[model samples]
Target chain A: MTETPSTGQPPEFPRPTAGPPEPTRPAAGPPETPRPTAGPSQPTRPTAGPPEPSGRSSARPSQPSPRSSGASPAPDSQSSPGPSGRSSARPSLFTPAPGAAPVGRMLLAQTLFEIRLLLRNGEQLLLTAAIPVVLLWLLTAAPVFDTGDYERVDFLVPGILALCVMSTAFTSLAIATAYERRYGALKRLAASPLPRWTLLLAKALTVLVVEALQVVLVGGLGLALGWRPSGSPLAVIVLLVAGTLAFAGLGLLMAGTLRAEATLAAANLVYLLLLVLGGVVIPLSGFPSGVRTVLELTPTGALADGLRSVLADGAGLPWGSVAVLAVWAVAGLAAAARWFRWD
Target chain B: MPPCDTRGMSTAPAVEITSLVKRYDAVTAVDGLSLRVAAGTLTAVLGPNGAGKTTTVEICEGFRRPDAGSVRVLGLDPWRDGAGLRPRVGVMLQEGAGFYPGARPVELLSHLARLHADPLDVPMLVARLGLESVARGRTPLRRLSGGERQRIAFAAALVGRPELVFLDEPTAGLDPQARRATWQLLDELRAAGVTVVLTTHLIDEAERLADQVVIIDAGRVLAEGTPQELTSGVSDDVIRFGGPPRLDVASLRAALPDGSSVKEVAPGSYEVAAVVDPRLLATLTSWCAANDILAEGLQVGHRSLEDVYLELIGAAAERTAP
Candidate 1:
């Protein structure tokens, strides 16, 4: 049996002008110009008949023959206006233009879908939200460690919040994205109409939603343990946002550059290491001077110290730590963008 | 060279590449390859493993950039005008491409549909691909069987109603029935004037479906033509018939026309290789009669498309081997 129908020529068939043919006018104009026009025409026609009539009147006087010519050949074109007078009169549908989904709509759908996937994966959820809540409870109840001058519950609350941000923004995000790259999901998306920036934004938005849930659960637990925040809520908000950006950027950098298995191991290792040494559970002041100075500069340490200052000390904002987080965000994101491979 | 006439047809080829060169450090993947596809036809790229077919297709899809070449898809540079060209192009990857393991097929398909401007109806598409049974169940993509996953991926590719489609090993994991269904869908796409470029290992699929078959090996094109064209002149026709064992080949050769030879490839089966014609057949029959022999089940045919493909690949392998 014939695999392909003989009714039409094959796509590889040579055209009349095969070599160095004249450059054709770009096809971009036809598809883009008519989409917005077609979108509004469908909705507007039912509301007001008078507007369509006026539109037809204007279209007829300006470009009547060209419209007919465009529609005549594309009998199967989905957006082509029909031969009937009423349909052709609309002018917008008669243009035979191909439709493209709006960029903003695509981004929104992608972000929602990403969030759903993150929530559905039991492992991802455990890493991003559940683990942090469990850790917050464990660290506060256990009294084997020294409390020093500050209230033990008060100091540990902010550090766990910082840990939550690191888990969602850095470790979980890095592992998931690396696996997506390995599975060819990122390659598939890259081949679609979804712009690169839209994909990045969608992932970022998904991380934010998950982190928001973590904050609520952890904060509620802190409240039950008699931990009261005396700092400005605005300062806490700024620290959370900045911390998320810094960790997410670093996560993407690892996901983009490393293999899936490598990213998995490295992300988990970094999470555990930072949990102990990055001033999350342990105060930076407890360490010796030289080591403390370096540890305080780490992103996790900066985020934890910054949050502790705002939530425990009622310090307005830790501008120095915020500035450090900002630099890491910029450097990590730039590196990820430069070296990331789609497939 | 004239300005594009108002016939409304875009002058740019659906896919065009010139002198494409891609290398991964020391090894070259695609070398000096050039191809042009018209706006409404199906072309199959056939090759053995590591033949660069995937690399070439990825370049057209804008997934991979060629180290040295100019490439365009639907008149736009696939790399530079990717945002503009992608909406009009659909790509079916080799495998499931790591779909969310827990997502139902319908959910993922609908989500993909929302990415396009005017996509095919998701429910209708699911039914068309015979995915209705699996789609209704809330099985995660990874839990589905191989055939089920392939069908879903196929549906995802066509859901956008793209102007051009690139399929990489689309039927690799499908069953016979699903393979037939996939072929029918490809036929429909061709009828709708959508351009298709596929890479496959099945020679019969390429022979039956492809309007043009491009055979590549060692990162280069070995031959390209219609099935009929490729197999036409490669080998002479063979006349085969059952006969008595151990027939004298020297005498038969002297009796037959020049450039003709007879061999008993198998006991009691004789094969005559030459430009088969009425005269040669008559001579062979008369010789059999004179020798008190009977030729049974006479048949004549030329080399098949498969033979040509194998011959070309074998020769190229030898030529390129260290």
Candidate 2:
């Protein structure tokens, strides 16, 4: 590469009043033309640089002449951007045009990355996927509670699915985003040309990806262990999608506003509370009417209601639950959009 | 002048801010700061700890909302047009950003590449950053050195080929050679007409790379100028003579040639300050020769960024102290 002056000023560019003066030395090394070894007027050599004898004060000038030519290539040098060539034509996956297609692509790519990262994390994998599966297996095996005119697996499957969404969206994503904020990762991403919507959608997509895996594993376990779904398969899928959106949106809202440690505490607290109160383990219908009215507004209850209606009762989708989930999703996303701190 | 519009068919400043103020509760992080980064120029924001350098950069990046004043990057408000502005900006934050430990740079780059309008080749980029040897290693992020991780962050930032880039402490812990290489990458970016706004505590870096030196202290701009301009006004040569080898400073100050002032900056060392010709150095050497008083480590010099910074910071602290 051609060595340009270090001023960050292109030749012929107008000098801005705000910029610093041109530096006299490039810090490349001793000047390109070697200074006189002994006297001021020694003939400058083109190459074959003189060797230094250690501790010889004569060669040890206080300031080495700033004339080092062509910096020695380091082991970890970045390759210069080449002119438009063979590889340049192939567009990068994330650089989508400013349209829906690019936005969708960005969301898909980010979601996949998130899922891959979460699955690789031993702690997260155990909590989101393994723990739920283990919990379902253990809970269904015990005879502590009645099947309520249904198979024991029937009641446990939908609840486990709800737990999966909560784990993936509320707990894992919240913790991850909180840490990202604390560490300045999100602030770093904000510097990039990626759209804000693309960033949010990408994160949401990643949660959904993890949730998708959770659904397959838990749903398969439910079927294999004799849990029957009364609702149509299509209705179950719609409900699952809605629940994922709601939980992920809420996760974003919490992660964006709270400190990492605080988010971690709050998410886990919410998770445990919902586990007991939102019908994940206990049925909402079993609660008193006043309690049910309050619980209905929370995302957990709506997710559980939607899941239970589809998986246990085999009933058509409940519009009220759908509306509640939709409201949560919208509100969560909006709140996150307004309050999220990048650093 | 009202703001210069560079939106169409004009080469204008890439960033401009006027008296930018960002206050959080009782603490004002950025106070009455104004700066401009021309298109295709690299401006380094330099300051000591708690100088609000990062806060200022964050405001420019649109990540932090300023409580008062205005900031325009690429002629668009950063917060309002954050998404609209994203495709043209790149950022490399200081720490705690990486993919899952085992994810290859290829995979991560491929994912991030999808978010840009024009992105570089993943394989080529990986090779450039010296990640090719470990390209297939699938090493987890936790295993990489701080320097290696920094490189990964830098690679991620450039993956999008942004029009403007923000680098915060981009080379904090790198070895000398790695730092040089990173500087080369930045130089190349500027050559391609990309605007770079960066922050660093390294004075040598600010002296070498920044087109503009915007110095901040105690949440406000202490000074801004070209390196030469800042240093030039300070008295010229600082002639230091050893003592203990203790020559009486008053006696030496009297014996010094006209236009030189002497002060004891440190015990056993005295500084004779003045702008002098090369002959004055020879004259001093000759004077020591005649007196049989040896002045070892004797040096003549101009004020460096380090000296100016110390003085500026000292003055600012004194003014703000309770």
- TM-score of each candidate? 0.79, 0.76
Candidate 1 lDDT tens digits, B173-222: 78887887787666555545567899999987787667678998878888
Q: After superposition, how far is residue A287 of candidate 1 from its true place, in Å?
A: 3.5
Please provide, for model 2 over A239-270, each residue's C-alpha lDDT reduced to its tens digit, 9 standing for 90 to 100: 77777778877888888888878998999889
**DockQ-based CAPRI category assigned to the predicted complex of candidate 1:** incorrect
Model 2's chain A TM-score stands at 0.69
lDDT (tens digit, per residue) of candidate 1 on A173-250: 999899888867788888777888999999989888888888888889999998988889888889888988899889
Residues forming the 10-long window of minimal summed lDDT in candidate 1 chain A: A1-10
Lowest summed-lDDT stretch of 10 residues in model 2 chain A?
A: A33-42
Candidate 1's TM-score reads 0.79
Where is the poorest 10-residue window by lDDT in model 2 chain B?
A: B1-10
The digit string of per-residue lDDT tens for model 2 on B10-112 reads 2667888889898889988888888888776678888987789878877777778888899998899998887777677777776526444445556767767
Candidate 2 local lDDT, residue B151:
81
Q: DockQ score of candidate 1?
A: 0.10
